[model samples]
Target: MSSNKVYVVGVGMTKFEKPGARDWDYPDMAREAGTKALEDAGLDYREIQQAYVGYVYGESTAGQRAVYELGMTGLPVVNVNNNCSTGSTALYLATQAIRGGLAECTLALGFEKMQPGSLGSTYDDREQPMMKHLLALAELQEFAMPPAPYMFGAAGKEHQERYGTTNEQFAKVGVKNHRHSVNNPYAQFQDVYTLEEVLASRQVYGPLTKLQCSPTSDGSGAVILASEAFVDQHGLGDQAVEIVGQSMVTDMQSTFDDKSAQSLVGKEMTRKAARDVYEQAGIGPDDIDVIELHDCFSANELLTYEALGLCGEGEAGKLIDNDDTTYGGRWVVNPSGGLISKGHPLGATGLAQCSELTWQLRGTADARQVESAAGSNGVALQHNIGLGGAVVVTAYKKP
Candidate 1:
């Protein structure tokens, strides 16, 4: 099947923040980000043919509420929830709509409000008590299913033994992200921490310090996608960021139920997604200049290096140690501080990653720009993984 072409015309995001003393709801953030996106695109809300809103824990008709707040005109709105990948998945849907000629222009919005007190068990199943019991047990065990030769802390221990991926090394990720967060006006955590400070912090998931985990945050991000024809018609051909490739994959849920650290399911799914994207775009990993991987945990980022084929298996530590993934390195990863430093508002994360890539491809990522090598067309990749190993990858190129 021939791939349909699409373009990203505008992207916007609100400053990620922990819900503070003031009363700011998810719709508030959504309107702010969505308005900013429309303004950035030099278009009005009326120009949008459709809207896709992604949220995980928001109330029913949350998208409608936001759209109403933004002066709704009865445009069709579809709400989507796909765990952490909600935002990126929404973007994918919008792209497909435009590519399939279903719509000339679409708005993709992702927003979330941090639910008070422990996120309130969205995974609970009232229909199947037995399944719910198993899920509860898994949660109590920190999502580890035993007797499968893989436990929750097994990977950490193995990493420690093999590559000396210490708790401190893991802590370093938090410290680095916080340091970068200090410069991000939109980041939730502005306070920077030292490596020693992170090491001294409280532990969350054993070897993974509190600082290493992303906090529940309130934020929103939006992107405007248009068909190639629409972009040309609007005289925005030069301003559009080409969607070179995109892919999505889902693994057997039973694989995660098995809880094997050696279960390459997540990695394998991401690899297949990347392969599909590369084939569609006629490019390879070597052509990508920047990347934003789902970094809900520091270890996840390490695993992504291999998943994206950036390095061989077990070489992620070396890549990080050599600073190969930093700004001036061969491939820059997570210059937006990632979820670790920027904060993860579940639904908003994936779109935020795409927004970061849009900036990088447009040469507008001030202070975190990666200088593309000679004859190298700047390319950026966004990777998002949802619950139970659902993966999506999107590739973009500077026009």
Candidate 2:
């Protein structure tokens, strides 16, 4: 069956921050972002036919709460939680619903109010006996290998060794992102940092300094998607951002269980997504002008460069060193300052990436704007990776 055409009509986001001892909750943030998106799209909440909300820590029926804040509506509300990829998954679901003719207009909302504490530890669910057993096993295995590297940190080290990536090089990622963040009004870390400062910062894990890690942040981002017919009817044809390709893949749950550090799961899934997008949009990665990849850690970005075929294996370091990935350069990556500087509120990140890309495609990203390499026909790629590199890639095009 031919895939139904879907278009993103509007996108909105709340500033990323630490909440600053406020009473504002996830539903409030979600409603605010969603309302802004609807306004941007020149549509009303009543026009929305379906909604998907992404949240990791929000209460059950959080999707309903957010939509009800706008005004109690009868739209079907589905909640999604897929680790860090929740936002992207929500977007994927909304796109599918519209594309399948199940809905004319759908809203994908991602929000999170980060609780103070180490989020990584929250994965251990004491209620789940199996999860408790797994945690114990993980702890025992960790003790067996002295300084075995923290879960994600170990992956960074492995990539570092294979790619000859250095602490300074990783520091550069933080430096560049922090600098970019200064231009982003909504970014959590707006302060710029020099490479020396980043290098001197306290190390959290191996070569990764505190600045390289994403902070626990509270934020929300929303995107409104409509069928091609809806876009045409609303006189929003010119504002429509087409959904060209989308794919998601899951890998082995245990990071330690994987025989190889660099799993093809993400790579293959991204490739397949890219292929589907290329086939549908008649455009390839080479044709993409801007990209936003999950940079929960600096190494994740490096690995993604290779995994996304932006460069070959072991060549991502060179890409960063040469400044090929920064804004205004060839194929700008993370022009919105990325998770490192923009803040990663878990569930909000994926939709935030899409918001940034939509801004770029609309030529609204003032200082960080690319030269419109794709011209009026701009293309963007959003890449999100979950725990152990569960991957999703979505491609967008503006015609």
Candidate 3:
């Protein structure tokens, strides 16, 4: 397909809050984020020709209702849901509109108002979306924990048993992300914890502590996508960050065929998507200066290091021990605190990642900024995934 240059001209998000802690609904969340994004771009709601809104636990026309909070422009509003990757999926579609010349300007917005406690299916009348994956887990290990923690924790256990990865390595992810959140005003948890505290916290399953898992969150995020012509026409060149490459991959047969816990949680899908993004961007992992990867659980973060080609297979433990993924390391990852510390509102998570990377590439991220991304040649990568399953890998660069 033919494509045109697409750029993120503006981005905004609300401080992620524990669900029910905020007395807002999805529409309220949408208005704050959408207004900030429009103001950031120096544009009006009418200027957006289309919108894509993402959420997982809402009724029909929720997208339309949310968009109406911004304006009743009658633009086509597409509702999207792909489990945890919903936000970036909306982003992928909006970028496609600009890239395909279908729209000069578009809005990708995501918000979620979730119930507290561990995630469970809304409907038990039908088979769960992750039933197949659950069956695979049952065939391999005892299925005694909640679905989300069990699958992810089982993957971490497999990594430990197979690759000699230690529980401490996974716990470090929690420690680093929590520490990084101290500098981010939007993170849900800002207090730092020691490795002992993280490991000593309530154990969910395997090596995963309660501190390592993302909490149910209520928040919203929005990004404005513009074509090159639109950007230049509006004199918005200075703030535009280019979306150089992107790819989305779903589960493959190997996901179930491999009979491995890691594969069951989207390890292979992430690897394929990351490779495609690198090829499209004409750069390798070595070129990336910063990252905002999905760390729904600390275990997934470690698994993603190898999946994103940041290190060799079974070498994630070594990389963690060598201090290669934090500030002053080879690459600064999850500088926005990641989902573990930042809070995961499903639909809002990916847009939050995009906002952070855009700030990093623009050298506007304050205390959490990575020095490498503040340079003229800075490049950033984003990885967001959902099991049962899909993954979106994106590459961004300062324009």
Best by lDDT: 3
Residue 148 error, candidate 1, Å:
19
Which 10-residue window in model 2 sums to the lowest lDDT? 140-149
lDDT for model 2, please.
0.77
Ranking by lDDT: 3, 2, 1
Task: Give the local distance difference test score of model 3.
Answer: 0.94
Give the range where candidate 1 is weakest over 10 consecutive residues by summed lDDT: 144-153
Off by over 4 Å in 3: none
In model 3, the clashing pairs are: none
TM-score against truth, every candidate:
0.89, 0.90, 0.99
Q: Per model, how many backbone clashes are there?
A: 0, 0, 0
Best by TM-score: 3
* 118-153 per-residue lDDT for model 2 (tens digits): 564454546631243235335433422212124445
* Whole-model lDDT values for every prediction: 0.76, 0.77, 0.94
Q: What are the clashing pairs of model 2?
A: none
Put down candidate 1 lDDT per residue, 106-148, tens digits, no spaces. 9999998875433445555465322432353354344632211
Candidate 2 backbone clash number: 0
